[model samples]
Target chain A: MNAPTIKPFGECGFIAQIEGFSSDVDSGLFANAVARALRSNDGVDDAVAGIDSVAMRFDPAHLGVDDAREMLLDATNNTPRNTARAKSKTIDIPICYGGEYGPDFDALCTQLKITADALIKLHSTAPYRVITLGFAPGFVYLGELPEDLTAPRLKTPRLRVEAGSVGIAGHYTGVYSLPSPGGWRIIGRTPLALFDGRETHPFIFEPGDEVRFNAITPEAFGAIRRAQK
Target chain B: MMAIATIDRPGLQTTIQDAGRRGARHLGVPQSGAADRVCLAFANAAVGNRWDAPALECTMTGPALSFEMDIGFALSGADMGALLNDEPVGRYQTISARPGDRLALGAAQAGARAYIAFAGGMAGFAFFDSVSTYMPAGLGGLEGRALRTGDTIGSRKATMMAPVDIPDTLRPHFGHDWILRATEGPDTESFNPKTVRHFFSAPFKAGRRGDRMGLRLIGAEMISEDARAMKSSAVFPGTVQCPPDGAPILLGPDAQTVGGYRRIAQVIDADLPLIGQIRPGDRIWFRRIKAQTARQTTLQRQILIASFVSDFSLR
Candidate 1:
């Protein structure tokens, strides 16, 4: 008997999506479940999932879309959500707030009506969840920020937002690892570069991981950067 | 012999590219490389360059690059009206550019991207296992940025090499007469039959917003009646993503590693190079084919390449 819960995803790349859960809860369960479901399928070239859906790319040269969809459905229904299988890693990033290190730090303080010290404490208080990543290379999008800290992007994007600069856009927050044009509200700069193109494993953070930002004095930031180097 | 030119005026988008970096998609980094793959390949062939060898990919037109060293080079893809020191150089062919000679590329006369190939090879910097440059991440090429006015590029040392003797049979002088083949996607049936028919039947124009990431094909809007949201997943080059807006976005070099949009069709691998050559205002149409046929075509091309490489490798 075939497992019967899989459904059709859009046909662009021959993807069949497995039903999933919310990003906030049981995300590990979802990621493992999705990966498990598509692991053994010959038709599936790759499998990636969001909080609510798991998408698979089917190589038609290998199998038809209908067959691929059926295969994914069978896999999802047969396999159980393995939450305990995956462990979340928490990384502490030390950032230098103001001065030449962060160009938009002062502007952010004025806009949010919060002192730098208070912002740091609140930011560090909670473990930010990793959301989806898409804007640029090795860019990780994290969390719904603290309620008061939520802010829109600049009307005109800065020509160059230095890499490792921490930024916020609405409820979403992220860090720029590469120098690219972006419209996020810049709050602080992290001297640590997060993305490197040449390395085999160039990315530090993936979606669904937890992260905490620890504010450090310029001296500490410099010390960490040097140590990493 | 190997040679390179000095930039007098860098055109809109001039960068050195090879096949681009692979396996960086999981991290949201797109594999960026030659925007016009077919023409880039032809130019490489004209000068006996390797398929994945580094070459100058000039966008729109190109900067007036002066020869820093004497070398033979070939230009292909969109005719950029490329000239050497005020004299018109041959298209789909290699010519000599001596030191101090300026290679001027003017407005596009045919296509958007033009490739400049060196005989010995190109001077390259490494990124993601390849020399292809991704501009956004500031990786590859001269500091991961476009070539600028007054910038100097070192030419390949061709002391042991000579100007490649190109065969006239390999030349693709004008555009058109080429048909792109496509295969059904993993999500082919997700869209209603009408939308799928509209895609294969209708003719589309390459939009002005086209970039290395993807081409925004302008034509009938293909809407997915199913309002269900899609999960982010791995996307490949030439994946035809149909947004709710109804237009098809042809993912290209430098495209996102993953996307959440519904994909309707994937341009076959053989046809991806054709898409790269398509510039703004260029006309194109799609035809769906079975995977078997597509695979056969790819295999045929591979056999041809293997035979040529064995007999007369660019190296």
Candidate 2:
């Protein structure tokens, strides 16, 4: 479901209005420019660039909201950004599609106008770059899927989307790395835990990493889960 | 050194907290720390612990706590009729407790969040560098949820902590007067002058759904400028996001990493705890403060906290 449209946000901490599309090029360029500016800016922290908008945080204690906003304004408008490949990554995620693991497996097939077999092939064929990580921790949004595959989110969010459930919303496919309420059309599940608190790097995938998902069988998934435990 | 407090009866959303994950935004994690930070700091000071150490962050109604070891503790913020073994344990003052003494709190007489601090910080395993519980990821503080009956936590004697010397005159007392300061926002222009005036003039209520993420305030329906199809963007703590429904949601410690909604204002850093103490049905007014003033105040506050450690002896 689409959130109702409204006025633009904030004045100083970030830019007010900017037009950028969802196309790979538009999204990529906007993200890159914002990221570059944030990297260059001395005042900002937790600087994040999205598909069309960029948001950065600073200790309002050090960089006043006015200064923070102005800094972002300069980055978005005055500073020219480099349009280059995001830090490339080849993260391999082992998944279990269809059957019980993917409760929405059959649902995705019906919605996408394709069979289960074709759906998996379409998804696995592409190498998706990380669009953004928001909503929840370790939740990775990857996409630019086939247009026919695009659809709105569920009118009602599911009560519980198990960790590792892969979903699609508005041409974007995402994997839930934690258990939480979600609305995407889940098409598969991954056995390998995407989140590792024990890892030196807790976040398995970053905003700029490149990713390719590999499918696995349910039995193999069970064995992997057992071995990890 | 372990001091135990048995939960006689657990109330709503009481959990362990401290200075939450300080630098987790790079990993898309919202810092889920103490809701009312000022009170937590004072409570820590009262109990002879570091200001950043973990403590029990209790919401409106908290559980009846019974101590199982000889220890000292204090409660700061929100008078909830707290008592030890049916006798009152003074607010903002250190109180000694014996093993098996029951401590209880009733309805809040003032604020929303109350801090229960011990001589030592909350005894819990660390996650991402702090013990603040981020419930979404199930990290930190006793399985990342509320404290329940039979939950036992240990504490170590504070090594560097000194008895807080704040005078009673400076302590917060229940009052009806409060004015919050906010910094300018990118969307300030979008709001008509009349609407801006209304925002400052009207009294608003913190919605019932308020939590660590953000408190949803029910006020005048704010209209976005010319109706724009806002693209999804990054948001931060203290961001005041106005959804199309016209309601204002002020982001807090656990605010989202990104949002597609329009933002109207960002609360100045110094006055954030003001929002934290705002309870449902409480009224508040806003004033615009220059960022420079806010930055200066932030430094002053930090210096004030830094001055409390008794071991400020030359290294």
Candidate 3:
């Protein structure tokens, strides 16, 4: 693995980009470990883990930028033992695919030259990791959506994609926890409230969590929604 | 209930804000707080409240409120033609309200957001350790949303202090043209020399899409040498991201924690409050400064704010 490059991001932040990562799995684990380390590290204000980089904000008053950089370098070299991938949570979510719930179902299948049933089976079978949540609040980016499912984002994004809209962009899948403008191809929807500020755990998927989708019928989806209410 | 005031006119996206939640970006939380933090802190300080105390953040339009009980308040940031009991009220100065007194804030004639801070801090649900409202996720503030008509904000009881006046020199002025200082961004190398030159030299107009999330700017099309898809990285307020279309988007306080666009520069911390006051159609010019110089500027601003707070006891 190539050594990570720790560089200044803004005036008060530093990002460590781990280039030439051995594999997606290894990078995910490393990123999560680094993020957890920086989050708890004294003097660090904020920390976010990307695919192969970790961005950290610091209070220059408490710790100078040069000192923070050195601390980050030290943390990167020594990954904490307690934050192993095994400590991550596995969450199974129920999704209603195709029909009215998925606007781009037929179009996506036609473009990929795959049967609808086959597509659903392939998507539901894989266990995806919670890579990051960058775009919006509670929005979780889970990946690596079987390379076969890799697709480009829409040329023109929709003005408003409703909350719980499950979308696939590039090699990842994500759930829009809130209504937002997005370019990802929507393939399904979930009934579960992925984000609720009132709850102790506002977001269902945290970084490092493993997620798998369970295909459900429209009736089942409605039943689950009713039960929650 | 310690009802202090009832919102008669909710105004445009008025909400309670504090210092905001820290060390939560990994949870996809943006530092959602006052757009112009300097003003918020100033208003809070004038009323003898902690710097991070919850305060009302009025948007382009201001709200009309009726006091349930006597209270002390301060108006700062945008001059939204504030009036108390039909009498014109000045900015940067604390004003005392009597029971049943009506306070009104009109449409912004100058800047974008205005801050109205009460003597005692506002009582709102503390989500993720802050009262600052994060609108997109419906988190923090009153019921995790913006203030609406009929909402009666409660206040903590405290000894009333005499109103204090902030010096004119300390007050920020809203102008048509703004100059923001910035430092180099991570993706600055991705842009060609010509684009970099245009970024610093050309003046950009704040587009219609300006909001708490980001301010989209229209200016000289900045072309980058590498059009390859860049990996998403951490983004913060003041980050000037240039998408494939070459238009720049200046991230605001409510911006996404991370993004994929290439950032050429970041507005310096000291100048961020100025960006928050920017309104659509305003002209913006970026001035490049060294990272060391930017740090120094932030330190100076911190000292200035500290001095102001230190004088609070004397006042």
Question: Sort by TM-score, best first: what order?
Answer: 3, 2, 1
Ranking by DockQ: 3, 2, 1
Flag clash pairs in model 3. none
Q: Global CA lDDT of candidate 2, please?
A: 0.71
Off by over 4 Å in 2: A1-44, A59-87, A98-114, A158-160, B1-3, B156-158, B174-178, B191-193, B296-315
Writing each residue's lDDT as its tens digit, candidate 1 over A1-229 gives 2223454333323333433444423543454355545756666655654444455656565887567767666656666555523546877777777787766777888888989888777766777866655557766667757888888767787767888888887666788878766778777778776876557767777666777888878888788789988
Which stretches in model 1 have alpha-carbon errors above 4 Å?
A: A1-16, A20-80, A83-85, A95-123, A129-135, A143-161, A167-172, A181-188, A206-209, A215-229, B1-3, B156-169, B173-179, B309-315
Q: In DockQ terms, which candidate is top?
A: 3
DockQ for model 2? 0.40
**Residues B16-58, candidate 2, lDDT per residue (tens digit)?**
8887775455456777788767777788788777776788888
Native contacts kept, each candidate: 0.43, 0.50, 0.60
lDDT of 2 by residue, A76-135 (tens): 665343343545668887778888777777887887679887888888878787777767
- For B1-315, candidate 3 gives per-residue lDDT tens digits of 599999999998799998777766777778888888888878987898876678999988999999998878899999999999999998777788998999999999778999999988888877788888887766778877788899999996544444445678898889889999998888888888778978998999999878888999998987678878877788988999998887899998888887888889988888888877898899999998988888888888878776775432100
Preferred candidate (lDDT higher): 1 or 2: 2
Best of the candidates, TM-score: 3
For model 1, state the Cα shift of residue A3 in Å. Answer: 5.4
TM per candidate comes to 0.78, 0.86, 0.93
Best model per lDDT: 3
Indicate the worst ten consecutive residues by lDDT in candidate 1 chain B.
B306-315
